[model samples]
Target: MWGLVAAGLFALTGYLAGSAVGHLGLMGHPLALRTTHCWTTGPSTTSRGGSTGGDWDCTGLAASGGRTHRITATGFTSYPVSMPVRVAQEPWGSWVPVDQGGWNKAGRALSPLVPLALAVTFARWTLISYRGWRNSRRLPTGSSE
Candidate 1:
């Protein structure tokens, strides 16, 4: 049951992420602009208690009007890491003023999807944890004597 739940959740997350990617691309949004890329950085290790070893960072960049704006998300500590995004837009030329509004709007719109994905992931993990607890309670506490 746990496995099934996990698989279902994984599928759902994938679908959501993919949908966001596709939508941003087609909508000519921040995620669709030229030079958009996401990079994650952190040590890859897990503790015995299921805790992560280091901080994780997710950074995305998009360029418009001869300038680049960076959107970054970060996570740390245990599960369900919170990744608040930050945007830094560089001023280049006269085109910068005209493009700023659209870029800012796009960035703001795309921002919520991050938390949505995280919420879905957390729900899935919660389901798995609940199933484990249920199963453990059903099992006998001691060997037959």
Candidate 2:
């Protein structure tokens, strides 16, 4: 029974440690911008000067640019969120962006299983302990019956 209890505790500790390490690894990365764009609007039809060209309607133009741009007009524009990015590590290792919310969601999904495992382990140990106690109580005081 004691051995069972010890093994159960060991397994629980290992799981907790692994979870901590996983979270730490997930957080160790730098945020980065993955994409950008440049839009222009004018009467000139020439697509030169780094401008891609007007769309089918000839009313606007769009070009792939970066957050670092030199705007020369006053018009409605938008910058959408960049694509997900990650930092590269050594020759064979790489660092990927961590989705903390996703990790938390996964943890929540596993929470129920954790308790169930612990309960089963503890119940097994408890049953063994109880059985041993019952057998001891049935033995004669000092006669070894």
Candidate 3:
């Protein structure tokens, strides 16, 4: 029941995402994630947690159109000297930019299928679990077979 509801919500999200762009869920206006290829300006910072490393950040500077912009990557550490940085007026800009976010034609076409797949999987598991529970209830108490 809950799974079906979730499927409906997710399906709606995919549809909205594919049709138009907005600030809401999966509706971010696509932006061409292209700008100056920024190069690292200083040393990166990092922190490690118990098992998984906490986080890393690298600062960079990009020069384009006689203007230099500073950019930072939170989860990126020392490695590539240059990285593509996008400057946008809106915070959600490039949030799901089709060109950069891999929202290809096929992806848009098949987005609705994901919810169906999830619903089927959830229903199957629930049915199997319910049958097992029913069979267990039918067994006499203290029976180990």
Show the lowest summed lDDT stretch of 10 residues, model 2.
55-64
Candidates 1 and 2: which is better by lDDT?
Answer: 1
Q: Give the per-residue lDDT of model 1 (tens digit) for 1-145.
A: 5446555656655554444343333323333222233333555656554644564444445555777766443331222222322222222110110112467447644655665566567677778788878887788879442
lDDT of candidate 2 over 29-118, digit per residue (tens) = 333423335343544445564644342111112222433322221221222233432222222232222224676647734654664577
The numbered model that scores best in TM-score is 3
Residue 99 error, candidate 1, Å = 10
Ten residues in sequence with the least summed lDDT for candidate 3: 23-32
* lDDT by candidate, in order shown: 0.44, 0.43, 0.46
Residue 73, model 1, lDDT: 34
Q: Can you rank all candidates by lDDT, best first?
A: 3, 1, 2
For model 3, residues 57-85, the per-residue Cα lDDT tens digits are 44446454666655543322233333353
Using all chains and alpha carbons, the TM-scores for the candidates as numbered come to: 0.29, 0.30, 0.32
Q: Is candidate 2 or 3 superior in TM-score?
A: 3
* Model 1 misplaced stretches (Cα beyond 4 Å): 1-100, 143-145
